[model samples]
Target: MKGILSGFLVVVHLMVISQTSPTDFLFPAPPNQKELTSQKLWSTQYYIHQFQSGGKIPIVYADGKPSGLFADTCDFCMASLEGTAFVKDSSGNSTIINFAKSGDSSFVNCRACKRFAASKLNVESWGRTLWSKSQGFGDGVKNYRLVPFRTIAVDKEVIPYGTVLYIPAARGKKILLPDGEEAVHDGYFFAGDTGGAIKKNHIDIFTGIYEGNPFPEVIKSNENKTVDAFIITDQTIVDALAGLHLKKAF
Candidate 1:
């Protein structure tokens, strides 16, 4: 019986490492090789929250009274979408601000009062709902909150949300995590966010903005570059990475 149990454990370990889809049974049947390998094809790009200090647009109250300036147009664009921006204060210190869309007016939360004119920033900021306050910036689809360096947006039809992926090209990259810790990429990424542009054969990596823009630069160097990717079948590893990503920290 002990020998039989040891054999069972070995089979389980092999199953976990072999990239079995979650839908598979405990003793999964063999997969179609072509279908399985097809998921390996990936085109990688990255997205970032805006962090411009030299912004040209002014964030103002609904009445058109000036409140603060955005870092730049790209900063304004991403801030509206991502729900967060790093703004330059009077003393030239960068500060974090949050935005939420409400009808014709958008609410800018940080240094100013709640109601802000959408007309000032233009029409692009009109449709998004308020960002989750508890999420620090914004939440992803469902319960998957966005994590700066750890989250990747995928076509849900291809790679389901909560799936764990391994990218060989990103394996040894080093990054400064949000909590100010320097960490090495384990090559594991969580599929937590989605975008309209994220269709088949593509994955959008979320490399959150930082003051110095250091970590983003590291990820940017690899942007638009294709790399071999694998879905991790190991439930233990998937759960660990997914849980960390949902916690909204690296």
Candidate 2:
């Protein structure tokens, strides 16, 4: 009887080993050769917000007042949209294969327009007003209230619109002012906005006018300062690896 019990135990051990072994049941069958020959396909769209400064430009508005330094040639207040593509592999690795910029032609001018166009310094002066408008100037107007110091563009499917986020400084780097001082800026910015330059997980911070002046100094000073941007995401990567998508939308 002892011999029979020992034999039964041997059979149970063999069964367990077979169940766990890669050669037995642990490995799935390789994909079919013909299916493997087929290319994998994935599709995704990338978008950015088109943000225009709230001030008026020199052009005439329908209301006919001087659009100010930045005013109503459709210069400062517009939104943009562009598209991009991504590919997925059998191993579930996704990569962005192509990105293209598409949208209103007006959006391009906001970023690339010259500071002094043909001798009019509209572009230069407007940058100062942009800073001032963001820092809480121009009450009594409906659209002139200060927005937020920071604007983050996110995937609505991942992080919903109108959500407020608390952005901390970037790792190991503090925000430096023109006075050469390091300051901690902890602020809450709502997700009510978007921009052509702002991609998923990317943020564009609005710094106020340095000394009530725009143009060369304010523009030059912007080159070196870094601001903390807070963005919301659900830890899912549908296109490329998470963080900000900076590729130009086609």
Candidate 3:
């Protein structure tokens, strides 16, 4: 019985790792894929209160189009979908990928393809979100929020990049700020990208905003230091993110 239990544990572990690991889902039909909505997908899996700084959580695109983050098969290089092939992921040049209605999928390469983590990502930031150019990742090409949630730099030691965090808002719970303001606790985020400033117990969240683009002054400012977030480690939750990663429609 002990041996059987051990084997079962190993199997479970393997399954979890496999799900958390990166698996490519084909998104050939950009239009249909854009039609997919997180509302239906997250109806059951996500529900945790996000105790962050001022301003409501970044709103998910209502049109059902994702922030357009394709995996940088080659680190943070310039990558984009062209027809059915992933190209120019290592240069600053820009290109376009057209997904037709036939629905053919191609795999994008990743410089750092890893699995989910079980620890709090050690990153050092006041918890703000920024986009490609602002983050110094060059957004001239195909700028995308690849991981679905607001991106964040994580400590590889704590939480491995690509881990999905389901930060739920209380079932209508709002938080009062120290400066006589109200902030709602809500958002679902993921750990897709990373950064050097990310250290122990600190996470640098990517706002997906470029410097020139108009953005809230609060995000760039260090006003909100530590935001409380709930990390989801359930296998089912990981599976859900994987299913949604890189693909368009639900």
Best by TM-score: 1
Highest lDDT scorer: 1
Q: Give the TM-score of candidate 3.
A: 0.31
Root-mean-square deviation (CA) per prediction:
15.1, 26.7, 22.0
**TM-score ranking from best candidate downward:** 1, 3, 2
For residues 41-106, what per-residue lDDT tens digits would candidate 1 score against the true structure?
A: 444434334343454555553344455554444445556554444444556444444443333553
What's each prediction's TM-score? 0.54, 0.29, 0.31
Off by over 4 Å in 2: 1-57, 62-159, 171-183, 210-250
lDDT of 3 at 172: 24
Give one clash count per candidate, in the order shown. 3, 19, 21
Candidate number with the higher lDDT (1 or 2): 1
Model 3 agreement with the true structure over 1-250: per-residue lDDT tens digits: 1233333333323322222211222111222223333221111111001111112222112233433433322221121111111112223222222222221222322222242122123211111222222112211112222321234445667666666544333212333321223434234455654444445545544322111211121123232343334555555545554444433311
